[model samples]
Target: MTYLNTRGSRVSIRMSKESDLTVLVIGSGGREHSLVKICLNSPIVSKVIAAPGNGGIATEAECHPVQVDDPADIVSLAQRVEASLVIVGPEVPLAAGAVDALEAVGILAYGPGKAAAQLEASKAFCKDFFARHGIPTAAYGTFSDVDSALAYLDTQSYPLVIKASGLAAGKGVIIAENREEAASTVQEMLSGAAFGDSGRQVVIEEFLEGEEASIHIMVSGEDYLMLPPSQDHKRIGEGDTGLNTGGMGAYAPASIITPELEQEIRDTVIRTTIDGLMKDKLDYRGTLYIGLMLTDAGPKVLEFNVRFGDPETQVILPLVADDLVDIFLKCARGDALPDKLNLHPAYSMVVVLVASGYPGSYPKGDPISLPDQLMRSATLVHAGTKINPEGELVTNGGRVLGVIGTGPTLKISAEKAYALVDQVIFSTKVFRKDIGWRQLERKPHKA
Candidate 1:
């Protein structure tokens, strides 16, 4: 197929036949597990491979070890496996120019190149982009030195948001409550005491107050397809009162995004973003993750991620009823995408199990136990686990596993998820009990 590149020049992409495609998914988390499963289910996919995959993924696909941040290593592996299509699951590889390397070697890859990946790799760049494009977001300032950051904080009100400009695995943001706290955070970030090089430059923005929602869009130039909206619980403690982690839990089709709100977001945020990318001449073709804050003013973008979210991906992918492989291929080839994706009339929820003291120091190598018979309604996606030398499943990372549940109703889905959560046993397991508390509370009680 032939399409117009970002430079307004004709470019051609060869589409592989369904029976001849081998997909290579890159990452080592529940999100990668979910992507591996989706690709395995596709009729066109003859085989699926993963790089440095976790224990659960090893059960489904061929797992190999590769440094995820090295573009040359990724390209070599794709060539070694003869991958028909490469699906990048994490932000690090995208920021490191893995897609650029693959495309240079004539390998089709589904992700934005390094230039376009700045939307997620650098908070300062993203905030500036929003300001330049008139996208609705909080007031912000960017600084590279401690004194300048502290001076910027003085101009803002209390309870501001301080973030490391570079990627820090979703743990680079902090909500500073007072002048002293904000100043200390700025010093720590600039001094490399907080997040290393990723924190040397910081972004200070006004705190946005509202319920948060996550929207995942598959973008093929001007055309796009949005999945069901989801909300992620970022805080470690219950009722969202504690330090932030990568994510604790998530639920899809968040009822908060009513038809009107979705329309407003489409018109005000998504459309504007696509126009901004075009204006900037970024040839983006991949998943566009919009982190939104639904405030009294309207739906405002909080941040952007170049790929699907973690626990959110666990829930959202199950609800998509279309052929995911085909959709990804079209995006990779810059072909026109369908206006809308077919979705199941169902709700999906995921409860993430973390190692003890996660979002901080935690134990590893602790043996894990699973149920004798896995329930059909639930899927156990591995996030941070490995097979120890003793040949046993053990904890290997902070967030260990994602227990996902699906049903016709949100309440039923939550029930099934928690039921399985009870059956899985690990020495240092930690998970949130209220995955869908807000939506469940809004439902009317049965008479």
Candidate 2:
């Protein structure tokens, strides 16, 4: 299969457009549920399979139980299912060489290999990669010893950002407002009390002041395709206060990222990063979750995740209309993307419902009940849910469900999402009331 290159001459490529293909998605989160939903919409997807899927996903795919972290286990399952394409949804598997295992056995998979996953697995490596490529990012330092870190902190000013070099499930980042807090947090992280081995090495950097946004790009060598811009509320409390969780809520396309800024990001950040990866000869494929801080000077990369973001994917995939299975297949096969990505002409928002004490220890196995009287268009994408022996739905993880709403306007979409959230009940339910608050305040514009 091939298409005329919009930039220059025509390009030919080896492609397979099999109409009867089975897609195996790996993960058990709302993001995986969204991937399953999108793949099911494709005409070529005869079956969608999710390993260790949540309750909602089980309704859509053939759910199988498997250890997600072991590459061998994932490879065995893919072989048993005879999957033509595999789409990985979480970062841990990608970091564990799941894609490498799949490809080694002649199975097509969408994700970066272990070598490229170092961008997310280790913050120190990412900072070095950015510095090596001259990518615009915050100035930073990496330290493994408390004495060296403290000695370096004395020369710096107040209000710094401290991060664990390894993955900590998104709770490894801490913003120290002053010197005293920075010192203690560094000690805690280095002492192995907070994040364990993930915090063994820490990266302290100058705090960037700007509104943050999430950008997704499907990269195949030098070629790439950008998704609609989105923003997520990471803080656990409303009005951006308290400890950060994976994410509370999200909406797309973000109004804060203007058309000019979007184009600039495409040129400076996405294009430059992909080209740099190609030049370095790293076999990087799959999704690139570029967390960007739109500073007054320009856009600077905050961090990179080798997989789709959680609540952000919950919001963004609903706005996409193209066959996601086709897109993932092309990306996995290193084929050029279409000139334009398809998306619905509307706003979408997702509100996450978590158990009380989330981003911390939370109770599980609480029976969940849904309102049967209400009829709405919102989608309840489940993340941490399970079926009891009595056939009742129960809470099973920190973040339970992602309630999605879509409409012609941001306010309407948010209202619908919140309304759907209100109908769901559990033993100890928690959610943010102000999802998409920033977008609601801004003047309406074309998304």
Candidate 3:
């Protein structure tokens, strides 16, 4: 098949036969594990492989080691494995041009190229794009130096958001409540004292107030398939009171986004985003995660992520009723997407089990134990785990495991998830007890 590139060039895309499909997923987080699981669930999938897979993924797929951000290494690994379809799971590699490298070698890789990935890789670029396209977003200023950033902060009000322009594994955003804090944060970011090179250029934006929700869209040029809306808890502490981590937990479909609000978001945010990508001649073909703030003015985009979200993916993927292999291939091939996704009429929740003192320095190589049998509604997805030399499963990263629960109702899902959360044991296990507290509180009587 031939698809027209944004540069007015024609590119050939070969669709692999489902009967002989070999999928290669890239990443080492719970999001990648969910992608691997979905691919494996496809009856047409002949084989599945994961690079730098976690302990749970290793049991289901052939795992290999590769530098995720190195484009050449990824291309070589995909070639070695003869992957018919390559699913790039992490934003770092997508931002590093892994998709570009893979496509140069005639590999069907699912992700945006380096230029399009700038939407997620650089906050400055995204803010500029949003302004240029008139997309609804918080007012922001981008600066590359301490003096300039501090100067811009003076003109802003208190309690603003200061973020590292480059990727920081979802931990680069800081909410400054006072002028002193904002100024210090700007200095730290510009001086490389906070997030290294990722903080050299910073985006200081107005702090938005309201509920937040996540929308995951599978894009194929102007067309897209929208997944159920979700909400992620980023703060490490309960009631969202502490420093932000990658994500503590997430649940879907977020009850906050009503049917009416969903349509409003589609009209104002999603459509405008896709049109802007076209206007800029960016051939974006992958997941477009829109972090939204549901304020009095309506839904405003907080951020754009080029790949699936971590804990959100852990909860969302299990509710998808379609063949993920087909959807991924269609997006990779730039085919028009279906009007709507086939989603199960059920709720899903994920409770993340992190090592003690996560989003900070923590211990590794601590042994982990799992229940011999989980309830029918529960699934333990590995995020940071590995089998030590002694063949004992141990914590390998900050966020260790995501306990996913699916049921006909949101309350049941949360109960099931917490039940499994109790069964998982580790020396340094730390998880938020109230993953869906907000929604559950609203619907106190609903099952």
Per-prediction TM-score: 0.95, 0.93, 0.96
Residue-level lDDT of model 3, residues 1-447, one tens digit each, is 556654444555544655678899999999999999999899878899999899989989999999998999999999898888899999999999999999888788899999999999999999999999889999999999788777787798979999999998777888999989999998999999999999999999999999999999999888999999999998999999888898999999998888999999999998889999999999999999999999999899999999999889998899989987788887887877788888899999999999998989999999999999888989999999999989999999999999999999988999999999989999899999888888888854343
Which residue window of length 10 is worst by lDDT in model 2?
6-15
For model 2, state the Cα shift of residue 39 in Å: 1.4
lDDT per residue (tens digit) for residues 241-350 in model 2: 88888899999989888889999998888877987897777777799999999898899999999999999998888888787778887778777788878888888999
Assess candidate 2 and give its lDDT.
0.87
The better candidate by lDDT, 2 or 3, is 3
- Candidate 3 matches the true fold with a TM-score of 0.96
What is candidate 1's lDDT per residue for 1-447, written digit by digit as tens?
A: 455654444444434554668899999999999999999999889899999899999988999999999999999999899888899999999999999998887777899999999999999999999999989999999999877787787788989999999999887888899989999989999899899999999999989989899899999888899999998898999888788898999998998898899999999999999999989988889999999999999988999999999989999999999989899987887888887899999999999999999989999999999998988889889999999888899999999999999998889999999999999999899999988888888756210
Query: lDDT at 141 for candidate 2?
Result: 95
Task: Please list the C-alpha lDDT of all candidates, in the order they appear.
Answer: 0.91, 0.87, 0.91
Flag clash pairs in model 3.
none
| lDDT (Cα) of model 3 | 0.91
